[model samples]
Target: MKIFQSTTHYNYDWEHVSTANWQKYSPWNEKTPHVIAVDTLSRHVDPASGVLRTERLITCEQNCPKWLTAILGGDSKSQVYECSYVDPKSKTLTLCSHNMTYADLLSVRETVVYTPSAHNPESNTQFTQTAKITAFCGGWQKIKNKIEQFTVDRFVENAAKGREGFEMVLERAREVFAQERERMEMSQRA
Candidate 1:
């Protein structure tokens, strides 16, 4: 009787295992393994003091509850940072925030409408509409610039009122103008 010997082979590279595994486990990979897109600005949690704090973008969809809705104000659907805070004791939630740009401020206009009908076919349909105006940051930089220009113009006009020579008034105006500009700049930087 003739017997044939069987061979089993296993491919294992112990030396290169670490390098090969690194890419599979790397956190910086371009594609997230399991990611669900969520509106970051729509998550909120209540504090101990009964006040609601709108959570920042760091909180991802995985951590937040699925019931939250993302509503961006105005005609455009661009998302901004904000959330509706629902109180356990009450049916309403108060909105709050700061540091708004001009575009941000303009987005506060919102309109909502609801329509309900009755069983009677000939009756007119009932409708409800509500409008709200929210406060937003008014692009403080632009306002500050306008104020500074007005201040300088007023100073120059006042200084020229009773001046003897054009050059002397101009020199004094420059000195005052420089001082005012420095003060404003310092305040802004602070």
Candidate 2:
């Protein structure tokens, strides 16, 4: 098994960052071209905690090596099951996801969290992400190690791109919100 962890800070408020999370895969985010589609399976708000819970199915096209594709039965597309929790009271967003495709041969579980930065809670958000990779091919220790390492490397590279894509979305969302605020102010003045 291989474990990967990362921490990043976004120069945006937690509320904006959290809202942008949902638009990470928007068409405007060119950095996430691998993401083909995202579908919401379920969503509900917890009355007691005022937390929103959501389930989603994500489909991604992977650029895997020919050898890897052959080993995995020639499938280049991957599906992931993701669940997210948005706690309004705590001002935190958490996402957990696992690969559904090729689960028998390899497993990848990932978790991400977004919260207000301690240094500047009102203007910055802290992002933390972790992933575990494991290969289940029996009696092939060398191959398993190679698979795990490859996955870890890919995850790290993708993590950077994901952050870039999300940043773009956040910037756009902030612009839209600013425009809306200006409109409201003008209307009120009128």
By TM-score, who's the top model here? 2
- Estimate, for each residue in 1-190, the C-alpha lDDT of model 2 and write its tens digit: 9999999999999989988888889986889888999999999999999999999999999887789787657578989999999998999999999999888888999999999999999999999999999999799999999989988998999899988888889889888889999999999999
Task: List TM-scores for all candidates, in order.
Answer: 0.21, 0.95
Best by lDDT: 2
TM-score of 2: 0.95
User: Which ranges in model 2 have alpha carbons more than 4 Å from their true place?
Assistant: none
Per-residue CA lDDT of model 1 for 35-63, tens digit only, reads 23323354546457563444322111222
The per-model lDDT (C-alpha) reads 0.32, 0.92
